[model samples]
Target: MSGGEAYVFAAYLALFVAVLGWLVIHAFKIARLSRELAELVELARRRDGKAPAPDAAEARVAGQ
Candidate 1:
């Protein structure tokens, strides 16, 4: 292949690698957030000494 064709192929491969890396990093972030939310849910359950409610926390915040 010509030099120009080789350069084009290399550019495309680099772009593909970058996109895949970004997807992996984003997935890791999502997993971390999910773990944090679960911890918060557990803390809330203990704080109120009852089962967690979907709206109860929001209502408490609004009332404050």
Candidate 2:
């Protein structure tokens, strides 16, 4: 390949890597958020002195 073509390829590769990195970061964020949400749900159940209820939890999450 010509030098100019090589540079163009490198630029596209760099862009792809950057986008991949961003997706990975967001994936981690989503995981963290889910964990935090579950913790909060459990805390609420304890404070109310109720046993864990799956349907109620699903409805709460859906309402939000």
Candidate 3:
């Protein structure tokens, strides 16, 4: 490819990589927040004198 075409391709590749990295970081952040929310819900339940809900592993086993 010519010089200008190479530069354009490089720019596009850089932009794509940046976007992908951002999405991955965002996904991780969401997962962490979900875990934190679940923990908070369980704590609230316990504070109210109720049994904490089954976790993911127990739920999966019960589903089987």
Candidate 4:
């Protein structure tokens, strides 16, 4: 491949890697948020004297 073409390919590959890394990080953040939300719901139930709702993570963990 020509030098310019190699540079262009490298740039595109770098961009793809960055986007994929972002997607992976975003997925982790979402999972963490769901777990946190479940914990918050439990805390709210305790304070409000209501029954605790099912945790959002239970099904996902159980399926594994």
Best by lDDT: 2
Segments of candidate 1 deviating more than 4 angstroms:
1-4, 51-64
Q: Which ten residues in a row have the lowest lDDT in candidate 4?
A: 55-64
**TM-score of model 4 relative to the true fold?**
0.67
CA lDDT of each prediction against the hidden true structure: 0.77, 0.83, 0.78, 0.78
Which parts of model 3 are misplaced by more than 4 Å?
Answer: 55-64
lDDT for model 3, please.
0.78
- Write one digit per residue (lDDT tens) for candidate 1, span 1-64: 9999999999999999999999999989876766666668668787989887746654554354
Supply candidate 2's per-residue lDDT for 37: 81
lDDT of 4 by residue, 1-64 (tens): 9999999999999999999999999999888877776677678777899776565435644354
Candidate 3 backbone collisions, by pair: none
The better-scoring model by lDDT among 1 and 3 is 3
Q: Report clash pairs, candidate 1.
A: none
Per-residue error at 49 for model 2, in Å?
0.5
Which wins on TM-score, candidate 2 or candidate 3? 3
Runs in model 2 with CA error above 4 Å? 53-64
Measured by TM-score, how close is model 2 to the native structure?
Answer: 0.74
Those runs of model 4 whose alpha carbons end farther than 4 Å from true positions after fitting are 1-7, 55-64
Cα lDDT tens digits, model 3, 1-64, are 9999999999999999999999999989877766676777677778999887858534543354
Residue 27's lDDT in candidate 2 = 86
lDDT of 1 at 23: 100
